[model samples]
Target chain A: MEGRLARIGLRIWVGGVLLFLFVPIAIICFYAFNSSNIQSWPIQGLSVKWFSVAWHDPQVRAAFVLSLKAGVFATAIALLLGSAAAFGVHRFRFFGREAVSLLLVLPLALPGIITGIALNSAFSFAGIGLSLLTIVIGHATFCIVVVYNNVIARLRRVSGSVYEASADLGAHGFFTFRTVTLPMLSTALISGALLAFALSFDEVIVTTFTAGAQNTLPLWIFGAIRLGQQLPEVNVVVVAVLLLTVIPVIIAVRLTGGGGITRGSAAARSAMDSGSPGA
Target chain B: MTSTVAQGGRPGGEPASSRHAGGVPGGGSARLAAALWRRAWLRATLTLTPPLAWFLVIYLASLVVMLVTAFWSVNPFTNTLVHTWTLSNFRQLFTSTYLIIIGRTVGMAALVTVTDAVLAFPFAYYMARLASNRGRQLLFTAVLLPLWASYIARVYAWIVILQKGGTLSWSFQKLGLGAVNIGYTNTAMWLVFSYIWLPFMIVPVYAALERIPDSLLEASGDLGAHNWRTLRSVLLPLALPGVVAGSIFTFSLTLGDFITPLLVGGANSNFIGNVIYSNLGTAGNLPFAAALAVVPIVIMVFYLLGARLLGAFESL
Candidate 1:
């Protein structure tokens, strides 16, 4: 009886913690449809006016499209770079392989503020016009590291001899890759692509530096807040952005979740044993 | 190797081992040997160029440039940078106001790191050791799932909680207590930072706790050593790396994040990131801002190296 009571107490504590984590999100979702123009409580009449306003806003739409464009291009570029790097790292015994790997992953560790300032300074010094091109290029840099890690880890799982065997059977590089490598890596590739897309899409800190003059979705929101132009519309757009970012995020994470646990975890262990999990 | 393979191959492609017996030959070789080495190198370059260029130009070179500009002088009146190298940009960085902001940022990061670490340990432990397999997976996913959510949306979500009519106060009022005015407070900043960066803490701790072999815990119990001692002596040491990783994520992120403070930190609660943003944006002092930004990176380079050294020691 005492043990049962103790278990209930622990469970209650768990519930309270989860509630703390989730309640704010739930509140934001609730307030998006809020009839009141201001973000206030005590139930103003329910209206979807803000949502409509958000939907019709041209600036919001443009920012949305720009973010989408940025996300797609960034992910594609990162994938191309990351995939090749992964292949190179997996196969070649280069002298500075570990150094290269660290350099690739270092951006993730360096504060986004640092990356932003660096890119900002670099762009200005070079007199390069900051546009969607600069934004896409900026996003693709660190985003590459994430995709590279995912793909390389997955590649490690696929036997090296498998690729060798295909070559031995007189198969050309492209054909062998299409048949043998692509099939096994397809899942990982999809997950990595989705992850890259999400990272670029929701990214704010680095984007602020790279995005000069033009605003992506996140920057647009920040601008809206700074300008204090439209409150309810801002709330509605935030809700929309939430949905946009969350859906892909959930999908990417869930898809990779199982893989991260079983085969992925065992690899982490063995890598730890070797004292280098590539950080 | 290519010549050996070609010389070793038979017409029928049978007994491929014969390719090993074939030695390197002159330029005259089989039909399929169409400049393999050259092609491989070309393919490598072509495949590798885009990412390499992007990294070099955007990420790596940009940092080098920022470092250079941090030491340069800029004329605010003309909006032009002076060619003269100077330390005034850096000298002005340690002013009383900026130092307070830096201190606040580090203090908030520490608070968030500590709170999140404590909260994550039990949850991760239960999931790793106590929960059923499916249950554990679900909890772990729930933990990592937040990292995917929109950053702005997440920030806005917290405004609802910390604002005047937020649930914390509403509940307090419900319980016949006075409402808590958390808005624009440091508490609000810490709470939001902890929520946003909680996944960073969870993922690593979960990974480390999961790595704690089940048998080890059982073996401790078998020896009649209580759970506390076992956890202290075994689990803590083993999981320290993940804890360090989590700390880095929370600390570095909190220190660099102007976003959280902008959304919730109010006017009085400006951090170093916010200071840098202001100096660059509204203040229009790029050189001073660049100097402020460089400070954190210099701090982190040392911090990351220290973490690695400590990680090396912990592993040993």
Candidate 2:
């Protein structure tokens, strides 16, 4: 009877915690349709007007485009460098291999402020002007870790015997890699890339340092809120970004063979492992 | 096989293993590729160079530059960095009010971590052991959905909820409680941090708890151990590593966060991150900010080491 009561209490507690987590998100989604610009207790009225207003805003559009550009470039670079490093580390044993893994994981382990200020000062020191390029570079540093983790984890699951078998059948290294490894790694790569893009898209802390004058979507939202204007419009953009990212996240889940949140956690773990797990 | 290959012919009257020497078109390049691939050390070096170069040149070098820059003072007139090494930055940090900021950040991080651990335990336990498979999937998606949502937006939602006469205060009034004037206070920041990082704590703890075999619990109970005793002996000890693993994320993330405080915190709520950010962005004081950055880095280093000692690295 005591165990049963304890279980019931736990169930209620779990429900309350879940409500706490979702209430904010539900509020954001709901108020996106609020007609009033001034947010207050009990939204004034509901309408789709702010969505149009946000759509017409050039600043929002530009910020969205900039975020996309940065996310794409960062994901591309991370995929290349991260997968290469994963293959190198997985296929070869050499001196300092453990050290290399540790090195790759450090950017994830350190605080974002540390990485942000370091990158910020480095750019200023080198006379390198901060631009989208710099933002991509800052993002790719951690993004590579995401890609590396997913790819390496996947690589670990595959056997080395296949590569040797392909070689024995008169296949060149490149051919074997293209035919055997690439096919096997396709899902991992896709999911990893999507997750990488998602991370870069929402990133703000590091972008605050590396971004000179430009605004990514999150930075734009930050600015809009700081200025305390167009609050409804900001809500619309938040809802839109949430939806945009949610689709890719869902797709990544399907690709990874879902078994709970941990199925898609390879990317989440990678994001956390690189240390700046927060936006 | 060696004799036949050395004779340069096989049973079918074909040359054996001549592909590396010169057999097909572009044989030279193929031979070179085969020879290069055969050398493990050379292949490993070639493979390792690009990514290692990127980490060293871009990541490690920047960190080193920032650390070295922390030792150099800035020119007062032009705001340029001076090459002269000085301990004045460290001295200023130790002597000034920055120590309070450090203490507050660490304290808040600890509070947030502990809150998350407590709040996440029953939920994680339910998800790990009690929920049906379908319920588990729904709960998992429910947990992850917020994570994919924009972090700032979620914080903003809290702003909506915690504002004066907002949802929280209004709800409290309806419940016969007084107003919750938590808006723009450290209390607000704590709530938001705990909310945002709760999933991080839950996932790891759930993972750890799920791996605990039911037989162990059954064995303990069969030995006349009460349910509470079984939990204390079988569950708590096993989940401790996950708790530690999750704490590293919560503690470090809260330690490094500047935006949450800027959004929800009051004037007196300056964290170490806020100071470091201001010093870097507006104050143009690289050395001081770099010195401040060292605080969290040092704290995290020790925290990670402690977690490692607790065998939390596997869960991470």
Candidate 3:
């Protein structure tokens, strides 16, 4: 009887927490159809007018395109560099291997604002203009760790003997890698790239510093929210961005076999363990 | 078998023989592949150099440059960075106004961490232990879904809910509880920060709780401990590391966030991030911004070290 009562309490608490999490999201979705320009109590009325407004806004289109382009370029660069780093760290023991792993994790483990300011200062000092290219570079720096973590975690789970066996069977390194290793790593890479893209897509802080005059979708959203005149239109765009970001995340989770989004923290733990003496 | 033995005899033989056996045309590329296969160090170099060089040149070099910039001064009249070394930037950071901003930021970060932890523990406990497997998956997805949702939009949801005559006020009025507006206040910032970072706390705590063996919980019960005792003694201690791990995210995210304060906060709310942002963008004081940025870095380094000692990294 006591256990049953406790269980009831827990279920209620969990439900409440879930409501807290989702109510805001549902509100965002509902308000996308809100007709009024000003956000007031009870959302004056409902219509689809804001959707057309957001669609026709050229600045919104430009920002959306810029975000997509940056996410793709950043994710691509991250895949190449992250997988290579993972393979290197996994296959070989070397001097400063710990340092390398630490360096990769720092971009993520530290605050984004620090990463923003650091990159911003560096670009100015080096006379590199802040543009889409700089934004991609800034993003790729952090995105590499996401891919690195995913690939490295997958690498650890996969046995090295497969590669040795392939080599032993008269397969060259390239052939072995293509035939065996690539198949093993495909899901991890795909999920990693997706997550990286999701991250880069919605990133505002680092993009703020590296973008200079350019506006990514989130930066544009920030401006619109601040301006307050475009509340209804911002809601439409927010819902659209919500779809864009959440789809990739859900797909990535499914691709990773729905273990919950623990890869980021797990990779951080593994990286830390690899650096420690007894771990 | 002979090929295997010969390949064992010469490390490079496998690639050469494989090329020949496959009847593929040999070229300089094949020879280079053979050479790379023969030398582990060479392969390592080939794989490691690009990523490592990128980190060093772009990421680490920038951090070092930012650190150096923090030591320099900016000319107020011209709004240009004077390259000459000075300690004024750091010295100015010690003043009371800046100190209060730092304090407010740290205080909010701590408050948010605690709020999320308290809210997350019960939800996570239920998901980890009480829920059916199917229910657990659904709940897990629910927790994760918000994390990927646009953070700005989620925060904006609060503005609609908390602003004057917003949802909360409407609900209150319907209930005859009188009108209330907490919008654009620190209270609103607190609520939003707690709401925004809750999933980050949930994921790790759930991972930690799910990892605890059912046998251990059973053992506690078998040993004559009641449910509350088992939870207090066995569960909470094991879940501490996960709590600590989650706190790292909640803490650092709030510490460095200027957007929440900018969007949700009223006039009095100035976080360290806001100060750094204003100095960099509005004042054009890059050196001062870099100096201010160092505060979070130093605080986090210490916090991370403490968390490491507490085994939070393992939980992460």
Q: Which rank order by TM-score, best down to worst?
A: 3, 2, 1
Clashing pairs in 2: A108-A274, A108-A275
Chain B TM-score of every predicted model: 0.84, 0.87, 0.90
What docking grade does candidate 3 earn? acceptable
Name the regions of candidate 3 deviating beyond 4 angstroms.
Answer: A95-98, A259-263, A267-279, B1-25
DockQ for every model comes to 0.41, 0.42, 0.47
- The pairs that clash in candidate 3 are none
B40 Cα displacement, candidate 1 (Å) = 8.1
Q: Which candidate is the best by lDDT?
A: 3
Q: Comparing candidate 1 with candidate 2, which one achieves the higher lDDT? A: 2
| Inter-residue clash pairs, candidate 1 | B8-B19
Ranking by DockQ: 3, 2, 1
lDDT of 2 by residue, B1-316 (tens): 1232233221223233244435333554455456455655445555566677788888988998888888988898888888889988888878659888889999999999999999987887887688886676667667666666667878889988998878899899999997778899999999999998887777777767767778888888889999888888889989898888778778888999998999889888999888887887545798889888888988998998898799886654
Point to the candidate with the largest DockQ. Answer: 3
| Model 3, span B125-173: residue lDDT tens | 8887777767876787787688767788888889889988788998999
True contacts kept of each: 0.45, 0.48, 0.63
